[model samples]
Target: MKLALILNVIDPKIGGVMIMGDRGTGKSTTIRAIADLLPKIEVVEDDVFNSHISDYELMGESIKEKIDKGQNINSILIKVPMIDLPLGATEDRVCGTIDIEKALTEGIKTFEPGLLAKANRGILYVDEVNLLDDHLVDILLDSAASGWNTVEREGISIRHPARFVLVGSGNPEEGELRPQLLDRFGMHAEIRTVKQPSLRVQIVEQRSKFDSNPYECLNEFEAEQEKLKRSIIEAQSILSNVSIDYDLRVKISEVCGELDVDGLRGDIVTNRAAKAFAAYNSKDQVEISDIKQVIALCLRHRLRKDPLETIDSGFKVKKVFENIFGSS
Candidate 1:
C-alpha cells in the first residue's frame, strides 16, 4: 500500500490507488500520514483551486483571467491540499455550486468552489468509498480522468482545474464497488489484519506509545521522514528519464492479455508503475525486479473474475508474468 502511494506521487499519471481492507486496519491513518511526507506545492496566492502560477491549462478561470489581463500573479508555497470527502456530500458540495445570491446581487457569475477545487494538484481521500453514492463516485472518476470539473447551472457554465490523485479505502465486508468502477483505479491494495499475536502486540504497543507522546514519537521519525521526502522529490525529478526495456513492455502487455483483462488500462498502468518503481530506487533503467514488484498491484483488480476459478487474482498475474518473462 505504501509502495502504491509513493509510486502514484511520483507519477500522478499512473492514476491513483484503491485500498481495501478489514475494519480498524489503519488505512485512513496511513493515507493521511502520507500527506505529511509530501513536499509543498506552489499555487497562485489565495487561489482556492490551487492553480499553478504559470501553467495556463492547470489554472482556474480566475487565474487565467489575471494572466490574460497581464496582472502580476502572486504565488505561495503550501502543503498539497488533502481533502476528505464525506459520504453524505451533495453534488453541489462535491462539484461547487453557482453562488446564486452573489450572482443576483452583483450581476456576476461566481462559483463556490467545492471539494474538487480544493483538491486540485493534491490528494482527495474518500473513506468507506464503497458505500459512497455511485453517482458521486462516477463524478470523481470523471474529473480525475479529464483533469477538470465543469458545473453548469441556470444558463451559467463554470469549469476549473480538478486534477488530483483520488485515493479511496473501504471494508470489503460492507460492500464492493462494481468491477467496472473498480477497474478505473490504477492499482488495488488488499490488506488484512495481522494474524500473528506478536506482530499485533507490537503494533498495539507502537500505537500506544504514539498516543502517550505524539511529539516525541514524531521527533524520532522526523529524520527518516525527511530522508524519504527527499527520495520522492528526487525520484520525481528523474522519472521522465527512466527507461523500460522493449521486451519487458511487450511481456507486460502479454501478461495482461493472457489474464483476459477488460481493457488496455491494466497494461498502461503496469508500464508506468514499473518505471516509477525504477525511478524510486534511483535507477534510470527499469529492471525485471521493478516490474515484478508492481505488476501484481497494477493488474490484480483488473482481471476478469470467473465464478468457477479458484486461483487468486494476484497469484494469477504473477504466474502469467513468470511465464512471459521467465523466472529470472
Candidate 2:
C-alpha cells in the first residue's frame, strides 16, 4: 500500500512520505525492494545529473557549450537511482557546490552535482531521518517541495532539477522531527515489527534462503518483480487518462474540512494520492474507495485543531473519512 504512494510520486507528483518506526523493521528493506523492482529511466547521455532532455535545453551556458554544435543529444537508459542519505552528511555533500577544478583551471564556474542531484527524478531514501541535521532536513523539504536545487558559493549560483520522492525513515524513540518539518512531508506512515507468528517464521525462512543463495532468491521472484514493474510502467503511461470525479473531489474536500486540516495541503495531497491509486489499479477514474484508501496517508502527518492533546492522527483521519464517505 505504501509502495504504491512512492511509485505515485514518480508519475503523479503526489509528493513524498515520512516513515516513523522502531529499528529492525522492514522500512528500509521495502524501500529498496520497490526501487529494485522499478523501471529504468531514459536520460540524456553524459548528463551528470541524469536530467531530462527538455531540462537540458534550458541548462546553464557551461553545460550547453559542452555539447558540440549540431550534435544530436542522444538518450540512454540507466537504472533509476536510489540514493541513501546518511544522517551525518553535510550541506556541501547533500547540495553540492561550485567545481574547484573548473574555477582554478579555466577560471569558469561549474556546478558539481551532489547527492540530491544524483537523486533527481529518482528516490532519496534517508535513514534515521529524525536524527539528521536540522539545516539539511530543511534543505531537503524545500528542494522536494520546490522541485529545484539551487546552490550558491564563492559568488557563483547554480540551479537544477531536484524533483524526486523524499522517502525518510527514522526510529521515533531516538527523536522526532519538529512539527514544521513533519508537516512538510506529503504523507506519513508508521512501520511496525511483524508480530504474526506465521508471518515472522516466513520472514526468517525467506532471509535464510536468500542468505544461502542470493541469486536463487532473485530468480525466484524475478517474474513477480517484472510483472509489478510493468504495472507501474503501464500506470504511468495512462496516468493522464485517470481523473477524479466531481463528487469524489467534494467528498475529499469535505473530509479535510471536517478534520480541520492545516491549510489546503491535506485536501490537495489527498486528491493526488487517490488519483494515483486509481491509475495504479488500471482505473479510468477515482472511486470513493480510492479516496478512503489514501486519506490516512495524506493526513497522518498534518496538525489538528486539538493540538494540545495527543491523539492517533491515523484514527482521526479514518474517522473523518468514514463519516463523510461511509464505511468501506
Candidate 3:
C-alpha cells in the first residue's frame, strides 16, 4: 500500500522508501512485483548511462559519438532499474571509478560507470541494507539529494545525472542502521508474516499458481496489471496540478512540532506525500484527508524519542495528526 503511494510520486524530486520486515514476509518478492508492474520508459538504445530517449540531442559527445557512428539511434522502451545491492559490494562496484583496462591497454584516461550510473532515473533497491557500508549509503544519499553523481580518480573527474529512488529493505532483528541514513528516506514501512489463516492460504495459493504456470498466471492478472499501470500514469499526469492549502501547511508544521521531530524533513516529506496522495486520488487540490492518510508514512521514522514507554512513532503521528486536524 505504501509502495503504491510512493510509486505515484516517482518524479525526480521525490525521495525513496525504506521497508523493514521479517524474513518470509515476501519483502523482495513484493518489491519485484511492484517494479514489474511499472510501465516501461523510453531510453536511448545501447546507451550506457541510460539517458532518456527524448533527451538524446542534449547528451554529451561521448554518447552522441555512438549515434554519429550510426550505432542504432532508435529509442527503446525498457523496464526501469530495479537493482539489488547485495552485501560485500565494493565502492568501485557501486560508484564509477577509473577504467583500469582502458588505462592499461590504450593509455586512455576513461571512467567505468557502476551500478549508480545504471540506476539513473530509476529505483536502486537495497536488500539487507543494515549490513551495508556507511560510505556507500552516503554516496547514495548524496546522489539522490543532488541528482548528480561525481567521481574523481586517476586524474580523471566525471559527473553525470544520477537521480534515483533508493528502495532499501532490511530486517531490523539482524541489525540497525544509523539514524542519519534512515532519515534520508522519504517514507518507511513495516511488514511482517501473515498471521491470519485465510490470508496466508490465499497468499500461498497465488504463489503456487504463479510458480506452476507463470505465463497463465500473468495472463490472468493482465487486466489488473494494466489497471495499476494506468493509475500510475494518470497520477503522474495530475501531480503537477496538486497544491497545498496554507492552513494545511500550518497544520503539518504543527503536527511535526508537536511530535518534536528532528528537522524540517518531517514537514517537507509530509507535504510531498500529501500532494502525491491527492494526485493518486485524481484530485487537483490537496485536502486534509490526503495528509491524514499519509502523515504516518511520512513521519513514522522522523519522530524524536518518546519520554514515555515504548510506542510506535506511527501511532504517535496518528494521535498528533488527529489532535491538530480534528480527525475529519
Candidate 4:
C-alpha cells in the first residue's frame, strides 16, 4: 500500500503515532510493512525481554552469569521489537508476574516478565484499542507516559524500563477512547476505506498478487524498502538537531489556550510533533507550517465532548490553524 512513507514519519523511534480507522484500511498491513522495513536489532538469545546492549531488565542471575563466566555476551539478530497485545489478555500477562513454573520446579519465587518487558525500545500494537479493558488500558497508558513498568504484587517488586511507541487502531463506529487515555497518544490519524472504484480495484489486485507469491512481491519491493530504512536511520540522527524556537513555542501555547485544552500535555505533544515534522522535512528549525501540520495529530482527541454533532478533530484543528497562521 506504500504506507511506509507515512509510517516512517510517525515511527516509534520518532515517538509514536496512533491510527484510528475502519477495518479494511490497511492499518495492520502498514504496521507489518514498517516492521519489515526497520533495521534488525541485536538481542540476547532466548531472553523474553529482548535484552539488548544496555538492557536493565536482565535478572540478577543472568547478570551474575555474564560476570562470573567472563564470557563475552553474544548478540542475536532479531527483528526490531514489535509486540502485539491481544484484546483478551489478563493483567498478569500484560504486566508480568511470579513465574509459577520456576517456583514449582525449583521452590523459588522468580519474577516473569510480560508484554511490556518484551516491547522495550520497540513498537507495541493494539488492534481495537477502544474496546480494551479499562484496567489494562490504564496499565498501558501509564507505561506509555512514564517509560517504565513497576510491579508490586504477591511480595514481588521490580521496576524496569518499558518504554515503547504505542500504536493503536480501531473502528470509530464502535466508541471513542476515554479522554484520559486519549491524551497519552502523541499523534493521531484517522484512516478510511478507499472509495474510488479505481483505488478499490487496485487494493484488491495488490492483495491478490501478494497472497499468490508473498516472497516474490516482497523481493520486488525490497530495494525500495531498504532505501526507506536508510532514510529512517538518518532521520533519527538528524532529529536531535531540530530546533523549537521561542516564536514557535509562543504560537504553540497560543493554540492550546485558544482551544482550551485541559493540561500541559497538549502543549508538550504539540511541541514534540512540531519537532518531528521539522525533522521529517530535513529542517533544523521548526516553522509555522510545522505547527499547523501537527496540531491536529497532537490535540484532536483531547477536545471537549459534543454529543450533538460528530466533528473530525483534525479538520477543526486545521481550521483554527489557518485562522491563526494564515492559509499557505
The numbered model that scores best in TM-score is 1
Which residue pairs clash in candidate 4? none
lDDT of 3 by residue, 1-328 (tens): 4553355344445578888988889777777666665678877777667786546532534666676786756767889777777788898888878886787799887877888888876778888888899999888888877777878876667777776778788998988688888888888888878889999999999999999999999899899888877877788888888899999999999998998888888798888888877887889889988898888888887876555859887888899899999978
TM-score of each: 0.97, 0.91, 0.91, 0.88
Residue 209 of model 4 has an lDDT of: 100
TM-score of 1: 0.97
Per-residue lDDT over 1-328 for candidate 2, one digit per residue giving the tens place of the 0 to 100 score = 3554454554636668888887888788887777776777878787777767656633434446556355567778998888999878989999988987788799987777789888887889898888898889999989988888899877778888787788888888997898788888888888788889999999999999999999999999999888877888877877788898788888888887787776888888888887778878899888888887788988877855464877788888898788888887
Q: Scored by Cα lDDT, where does model 3 land?
A: 0.79
Query: Which stretches of candidate 3 lie above 4 Å from their native place?
Result: 1-5, 56-61, 64-73, 100-107, 306-308
lDDT of 1 at 144: 92
Top lDDT: which candidate number? Answer: 1
Q: What is the full ranking by TM-score, best candidate first? A: 1, 2, 3, 4
Q: lDDT of each prediction vs. the true structure?
A: 0.93, 0.80, 0.79, 0.75
Ranking by lDDT: 1, 2, 3, 4
Cα-based RMSD of the predictions, in order?
Answer: 1.2, 2.4, 2.7, 3.1
Which regions of candidate 1 fall more than 4 Å away from where they truly are? Answer: 101-106
Q: Once superposed on the true structure, which residue ranges of model 2 sit more than 4 Å away at CA?
A: 4-6, 9-12, 54-69, 100-106, 305-311
Pairs that collide, model 3: none
Q: What local lDDT score does residue 58 receive in model 3, on the 0 to 100 scale?
A: 28
Q: Any residue pairs clashing in model 1, and if so which?
A: none
